[model samples]
Target: MALLVPPRSRTGGIVALVAHPDDESLIAGGTLALAARAGVPTGILTLTRGELGPIGDPRLATPATLGEVRERELAEAATHLGAGWARCLHHPDGELPWVDVETAAAEVAAVLAPLAPAALLTFAPDGLYWHPDHIAAREIALRAAALAGPGGPCVYEACWEPETACALVAAAAARGLPASLWGLEPEAFGSPTDGLPLTRVDVSEVIDRKLRALRAHRTQIDRGHLFATLPDDLGTAHLGVEQWHVAGGPGPDVLGALLGEAVRV
Candidate 1:
């Protein structure tokens, strides 16, 4: 029989597994920041250095500079989120989807076994944006979560509900900001039925950290344009809220319900 525990009692230790450097910011930075603020040990596992990313400065995208630049950016951003450790897998960008899941899972398992976080976070099916690498990362994380075994870490997937996204776009438009590319098109938003069943994670507390982290990827995203195009209030109303599909395991909402500290939507 499963042992009972008090609500939000299991505290400390959380991990985020993603395909690229900036993915942590776009997808799960708020949750990361929340974990850090709670004094929980948080780890980030980046599958690639994002060498394939196209940037305003073409030179920054080259083989030699890309890795170093992205690594630095990732480190700085992770620091802003109060992340404890950041590990790079160095898989070639755009090529990760083709990597063997078992092999990838084994590598992830090795790291996770030692850290022993209470939860593991990752991408959902359709990859949030349908990027090939993102999809592969999801597969790898799912396998890794399984390999992590019972009492290891509960798994979670990033997800944006259709109704919520629509409301967000309306709010953005009211604030004179361009609707999110995906929000503008139903097809781009991906399948509604694909997300796993779980609780939504509110992230109002560390929204600024997420913004700061996103700004650190200057080559990929124009900070000035982001601020000018999307005002803080509007951005907060939209991005400050994030959701997750928790994979029930030995623990229920070990990270979200416990250390997450925000109301669920």
Candidate 2:
């Protein structure tokens, strides 16, 4: 069955290939919202159902249940953000136990040929927070990109800028804030600070929507820590402006350069 709830599409289209349901919110929420607000078409390709998550209930994360629940939530989040289509490749959540790169890449390639997005979003090799599933998702996207051909879509990595990351660290240190939120490590604490460059995307328009989506994943973000200390506006203020490391492009700033526009936010 088709996973997405169709939306009213606009001129330009964007496709985001990610590892899980919450990933679109955590990583590219703002951008997805921006595309929707602009009336641009936006779609998401989540490679797995996130069934392997370390949640307390095993039954809740079952392949059948988790897949459908994830699909439901993803569709809702997309509608909330005005995104276009949402679909999953249905690959096993954890280690395939038997899948190879070429096979997975072929699955992704089939989707790309039809979507033909103006821009594509996915994880960097670092996998942002170092989730193994995320790393796999990145590889799939890269291989799919190659098969789809260079001219298919402008790929964007959902990543933090090294300079901005360092600044975030300074901000946390100067403020005497703990290096975690809800027991989750601080965004800048352990990530590579430099030597890895990135592109910046201004997602100010839908920052509020992103926050709402994040909250929707109550299972993950409810542990209560840094997020509680900062007001929603303040927290989202940081998320409003996003950054990415472009894997293949003229450079990190290719989006701004190619789009010929920059958001002041």
Candidate 3:
């Protein structure tokens, strides 16, 4: 029998699984903040310490201590995002794709099965920008959820609407900043605009919390980042909303219902 999760009113829990320490905040910080504020339990599962990530400022960490520093940062970020609990596994960062998927899935399943979260959010299979680690994270989350069969959490991929991704580049161009992201042109940065079920959560009220969570990952996101090029107001204008799609399991618009957002499927 499927485990009983709390209904759409959100009395249950939410867990976000991601490839790196900062990904939890980058992908669904606002939603996590909103859920926590509403007294819903929130959790984060980071697959790696992100040792291979950029050193936004060399002063924050050296090559030898980057992983340890990032682990601390992830804990702090989880606090800022209002996650009640979080854990980062000892997995290689950029080389996540080469990890043994079955072993990783079993490890993830061990954590998730106990919580039986109402929603499980992670990267899309395409990894949004096609990052291999992001793709691996999605696979891990899905397989973990599957291990629970009908009782598994509803899986969702928090992502940008194609238009939103395109607009970010346009906005950067308007400011005379680079108009590309991760070397991909604006036209290639987001999920396909195919007619998939979607939910747009208006997270304006908790945007500040999200910002703080992102800021907590100081070693990864510096002021020189594209998001930082825009002023706080402009950045918030874009970050205030988040997009998602249900990928598996029988579930309602778990996040939408929690935040009272209109489901735009």
Candidate 4:
């Protein structure tokens, strides 16, 4: 029997390989939605089922079954994001960093090779918020890129621009929440301000779908969650834009073409 509701897809064009169930939606749902809208087939490859994540409702799942529950949620969330396919590996959540990246990369590359994706999307070095699983996801993606060699799909890292991150910090402070959050100092909250300019994706049109995708991860985001409570217009205003930077390129920019944004990768 399949461990998840859906088995790995035999084909794809644009794919987001990430650490957990919601990371794909939280980071690249809009992009995937846009790609699907543009007739480009989209997919997701989650490294883990996010067993360590929150149990939004007691009725939904228990700690022991969270992984199974999340695998199903990932499928639903991927459909909401308009992806052609969704799948996850059995890697232990929260212990991904302990896995040998070489073996992990081989697994990732094997799943990705036949798909011939235009772009490979994953976390940056900071892992977006420095989660160990997220960092490991990045390492895996980078190694997968290396395995594919010069002709490989470009790796685009989902990340926060320093200025935007600071603004978010300020927003939290304005809302009376701690400026420093997620175990990192306020100043260390995002990618370094310097380096290659980041690419901004205007996800306004598909923002609703993005919101829906977030909601589909029912076990992860609940009523009190910002995503769960967000009004469509407000969601647009707050989550309308997403950012990415090229980790390496010289491959295909199918995603960039769909977004009308150019990247060195």
Candidate 5:
């Protein structure tokens, strides 16, 4: 597919709601960076500071200080993505499923009210990796989008192409990496079989920015174990395009128009 730049004349903005600090970068950094480069205002709303995530280096942060460190890292990543703003709810990590759903939805709705983003990007209902926090965030974002009504932003969810996921899993196995490392299970990581219609965005233009943003979260990502360990060709091929499912949007075509030719419905 040919790459197309989003029109600079487009007004309004995009807001990404995620469960944790680096979730935005991991899932949609390239798209966000591209939007920012196109003059579309962009922001991120992270529900948690990711305090419970594995610490790559003990010197960087402790259990007590991880939240603070992650907050700063998230801010730095947003800067790299050229996001107009980023906010954290500082909710306890790993506890989102236990939080009051209505209350969380209200808070998310409040954030969306003022931004009135053209689109709201978030994780799919399966939460991509089946993380409880991710699922909770997804529900909250969907409810918040609904509360915003017709005039509010269209909602999109990042999703993996089944073929792409299978290929990555095969590659990881070839490298002797355990299936658990990639979160694979007897049912192929518990991915939904119904599947979602995909909209592909060629993010080659802003891949560097995306990588930089990913690297910004040093506390959570071990360079050698995660990013660096991926076979370069496979990594490039997979990361070059970001995919999304129109979750609560007016229509897939509407979102395609907003994102331009970069979006393939």
Candidate 6:
């Protein structure tokens, strides 16, 4: 594995496409924060406002208003991560696969045309935990990246390092943490079997920022949730490094240049 060296010149910016409001924060917030701290303009486009997600508090939002509430929460999270902007598409939650791919691709392309981020981050084909919306978002993002042509942004998928993820899951289980809180069942918590090249970005410095961004999505995350309950040392051990697998675009690895120090893992 070769270290991904940072680019010599800043090109455009970084844009993350996600299926729901908190996906950006949960999946790649630290990376976004790191990029922002490095003076790289960063943004996020959530395909849906996560209207179907379980509400943490009824007082915060009702069914009819959950979409709006989540949208606002996403914005706050993005701001906390130092993102330049955050936008949402009104696709129905849990039904993104039903959306017309061409239409979704066009909408995504439209968003990318203006910003032209050097790197486009989104879920892997497996959708991390095999969420339908995540899969759909990844498909749409890939289509949009293709539409962007030769000079388009490099596409990267948020990924987990298998051994490390398994260890974390075991540790969490040992602590009596509920799988539901982390959105994973004990049997389901591990990296995919397919071995893909990975880039690991050390985000220890921005872990606090990432936690704040996660907390900002109060509508989805409960006070006693796994994210909030993890001891600081465990959190650092599990979340300090964000991992990405190149999904599309040119070169073996281009993010190191676009963001900051990154190494092959």
Q: Look at candidate 1 and give me any clashing residue pairs.
A: none
* Native-to-model Cα distance after best TM-score fit, residue 118 in candidate 1, in Å: 0.9
Task: Give the alpha-carbon lDDT of every model.
Answer: 0.72, 0.65, 0.76, 0.76, 0.75, 0.79
Per residue, candidate 1 scores C-alpha lDDT tens digits across 34-141 of 878878778788889888775645645665687768877788788888887776787888998789899999998887776677878888786876888998998899
Clashing pairs in 3: none
Candidate 2 — which residues are off by over 4 angstroms? 5-12, 56-64, 96-98, 161-183, 187-190, 193-197, 223-230, 249-254, 257-260, 263-265
Candidate 6: the clashing residue pairs are: 6-256, 6-257, 7-257
Q: What global local distance difference test value does model 2 have? A: 0.65
Cα TM-score per model: 0.82, 0.78, 0.86, 0.84, 0.84, 0.88
Model 5, residue 78: distance off in Å is 0.9
lDDT, candidate 5, 66-159, per-residue tens: 9888888888888889887778887789999998888888888876776677888898877877889999998888888888887877788887
Model 5 lDDT-worst window of ten: 1-10
Candidate 6 segments whose C-alpha is farther than 4 A from its true place:
1-11, 162-166, 169-183, 248-252, 262-265
Decreasing lDDT order of the candidates: 6, 3, 4, 5, 1, 2
lDDT tens digits, residue span 1-265, model 6: 1111223344498888999988998788989999999988888889887999988889999999998888888888888898878888889999999999999999988777866678889987778777889999999998999899988888888886556556766677689873245555534433663656778888888888888898888887775576655555666788888888887423546678866464445
Across 157-256, the per-residue lDDT of candidate 4 in tens digits comes to 8876666555655554555543433234555645773665566677889988997988888887765455564556655665677777778633344556
Q: After superposition, how far is residue 151 of candidate 6 from its true place, in Å?
A: 0.7
Clashing pairs in 4: none
Candidates 3 and 5 compared: the better one by TM-score is 3
